[model samples]
Target: MDRVRRAARRAMFAEKPAWQRWSLRVLMTLAWPVGAVTETLYYLSVLPPDEIPRRALAWADRGGDMLALAFSRNVPPREYYTYRLHQPDRRAWITACLYAPESYPLLSWLNRRNGADNNTVQDKSRFADLCRRHELPCIATLAVFRDGSQLWPATPFIPALPLLWVKDLSGSRGAGAARWRLDAGHYHNGDKQMTFSPEALARQWLPRDCLVQPCLDNHPALAALSDGTLVDFRVVTGIHRDGWVEVVATLGHLPCGGPSGRRYIVGAIDRNNHCLISPTLSGFQIIKNHPDTGAEITAQPVPFWPAALELVVNAHKKVPEFSRFVFLGWDVAITPEGPLLIETNSGWGAFNHQRGIGAPLGWTCFPDIVAEYLDFSEHGDAACD
Candidate 1:
């Protein structure tokens, strides 16, 4: 089935004419409404029987308002509850579906501009190389594994680090990411153990292509918020036509319970004041303390907040390919020394912004910024060098 889908996609691009390819892309974008409806129904299906009517009514009201808005495209059910779209002024919130590159012709064009591509941001290996070339502070890959073989180090095992993170080269949202602790001269991840050899590790946790990097430790001030898992900040940066870069939104992901639990409490950080506010669990329930440790969520401002923002903004400027993107979502870790770039997402979602701010991005300057990029993509000769 996978091979058939791959071949069909290849033929769609290679056999079809440019016009047909674009028409298909447009058709896919137009099909988003169907997905939205399906998603809405699926969300309702999971709710208790008595709660469905109220939630369904809320969806209808909000879905109608979203359809009525000029900027609103698809009404994501998750965002509806996350942002409390049932309340007034829900039209300004943009759904995650719009972030899909093929959702708009101009977005796709922006992605393909100036030989710039999402690979430089999406692929973990490529992103690390870009950071290395630019001398940016980013998590370094100690070794890489591909096709059941070690691609780096030429050794059977990577030099043991106290902790290591193995993640899919092109994965996102912590999907297919794992943390291994070096214990008793063997790498352990849960009940599974490996002999430090790539082949041995692959048998346990590798996913065809993965990067092994030394796990970063959280800054001491922020350590109490999590159970040893590195909590990172999601900083959204936008680049202007004039070569200026600014942070559009900021949020912190605090891993609650523990690293093994794989749950996070996301909080919105005020980009202007650099203070944490609106801590939420699963994007809906507002909370004031960590569920596992009972630590105050906003007891103190984020440590080295200004420096973290500066690092991401500077790092974004260093990568010219990112200039073509509408906005880059930077996962930055605040270590005791300073901030380090974990990874970047050219196609970052809007859920964190909407959920954290408790309002729609449409209510802010984001739509205008997006419009500026769309106009540039339509008229600009080339992406920034």
Candidate 2:
């Protein structure tokens, strides 16, 4: 029963080291209040002052209860009224919390027994190996290092490759990710500079588990969109019980050259997964032209859209360990050859896609993922439609 599972989870959490439990509790306590205030402000911005109290009461009656409404901002009253009222009980509110980016620590802990290995997805070296084994088109690794020591039987660095990317195995948001050219090395973290070095590069810049891979010369079509910087498509997907893979949502992150170089420009995708319009940072200030090259990407066609979808769906099916992740965001690059796997993300941020877009998780696919999981927790039925 769901009650039994919750009790067991609480016991397991209590058994953890006191420091670890205390730290996690502190994080949840701190984040909950912030999320509550922020969500309240969001509702106030969109709703009438007099309607707020009525809406709050409705949310509580629907299973938000007192603690759920006060501690979590994953679901607002408006969203529940709009998209979740059809479901019985407060299932939708529970669903929102489980998938919220802020709840990752708790969700990962609860689902750890399901065999999700976030480190495998975080480490570029390990992820690259997974791609190679699956015969997926991916950036080839030239060398790998750990703690300042070179890994044996390396992939052989090519002196004439023109560009090499140095990455921290566990880095995110481009932290510690860098590009090395014949002239200078470019770090994505604040654009720091370093001279290229095969022997000492890892120690100097990386200083941790690191990997070197040849820079991908993106397909000409993709290059035109961002003036040659690698353009990554964030394709979020889910897998169903009947072995069907579904594309949940897709967005594009086009980096354009600024005075220094182009910063990340995020954009929503059209129905066909093409760039909808001039990409914008913060979902405002439409960029009609590239800052450096002045090329227009508004409504630009994304080459091989169908092939890319197939590749990602198949890639998801190949990794059983990843099955535990009900939702995942895959970073895919369009190359001259075809679609290439850049990286996989279990904890993808929703702000870029959902910030200005007023919709719940199920609006795109309408899959009752939370309902399916709840049934499984209470009835031991894992099958989902």
Best by TM-score: 1
> Which tens-of-lDDT digit does each residue in 1-385 have in candidate 1?
1121122222333335778876875886687677666656565456444435566667576456544431244345654544545445653434422322322333334455434576778788888888888888888788877776677767655356777887888878876788877667667774364345534554554346888888888889887788678988998887766767878777888887654455778877876666678888876667898888888888867888988888888887766766767678899998888899899986566656666766555555455555554323343322221
lDDT of 2 by residue, 1-385 (tens): 2232232233334436878867766786578666655664565455434434466666444434323544443344434433333255545434432233333443344346446777778878888888888788878877787776667335433344556676777878776676666544332222434453544444463346777777887788867667456888888777665556787767788786632655766665665445544366535555676665667767578888788888889887777766666667889888888889888887666545553233344355524533333334344433211
| Top-lDDT structure, candidate number | 1
The alpha-carbon RMSD values of the candidates against the true structure, listed in the order shown, are: 7.0, 7.3
Taking all chains together, each candidate's TM-score versus the true structure is: 0.77, 0.70
The lDDT of each candidate is 0.66, 0.60
The worst-scoring run of ten residues by lDDT in candidate 2 lies at 1-10
- Name model 1 segments beyond 4 Å from true: 1-78, 89-106, 154-157, 191-199, 202-207, 375-385
Cand. 1 TM to true fold = 0.77
